[model samples]
Target: MAWKVELTETARKQLTRLDKTQAQRITKYLRRVMMLEDPRDAGKALTGNLRTYWRYRVGDYRVICEIRDAELVIVAVEIGHRSEVYG
Candidate 1:
């Protein structure tokens, strides 16, 4: 079953801060991968304090998300450059 993808308000704002092309790429990747396939299979699970989240790479950008399998929802929590995303 296809999953529903939702972006948090903060994530939406973060995407606006990115370059147009980069934002588009990230959005496309999220739709194609996160929505169509099992999100856990599309990205690596995050470790340490952020263990609850998953990370999907789109070039230099990182898409941080939380997957809810029971609800079939993939919520994008944050989106930013790799260097700043984790911080």
Candidate 2:
């Protein structure tokens, strides 16, 4: 089933602050893969206090999402570089 993808306000702001090329790359990846594919099949489940979220990697960045099964929406909670994303 195709899932709809959305970015939280924080995530949107974070994305805009990234380099133009990185932002474009992330947008393309979300549209092509996160939107079209089964989100659970492609993303890795997070752990610890963040266990409810799922994570998808695009190059050096990470996309942290919360999957809403009933609504069929994948909400991006945060987006950042590998070194700082989880913190």
- Per-candidate Cα lDDT values, in order, are 0.89, 0.91
- Summed over model 2, clashes come to 0
Per-residue alpha-carbon lDDT of candidate 2 for residues 1-87, written as tens digits (9 for 90 to 100): 777889999999999999999999999988876555577777899999999999999999999999998988999999999999999
Q: Can you write out model 1's per-residue Cα lDDT over 1-87, one digit (the tens) per residue?
A: 888889999999999988899888988898887556677877999999999999999998899999998999989999998999999
Q: Itemize residue pairs with steric clashes in candidate 2.
A: none
Q: How many clashing residue pairs appear in each of the predictions shown?
A: 0, 0
TM-score to true structure, per model:
0.94, 0.93
Which of the numbered candidates is closest to the native, going by highest lDDT? 2
Candidate 2 error regions (>4 Å): 35-37
Give lDDT: candidate 1, residue 55. 93
Per-prediction CA RMSD (Å): 1.0, 1.2
Q: Show model 1 residue runs off by greater than 4 Å.
A: none
Model 2 lDDT at residue 58? 93
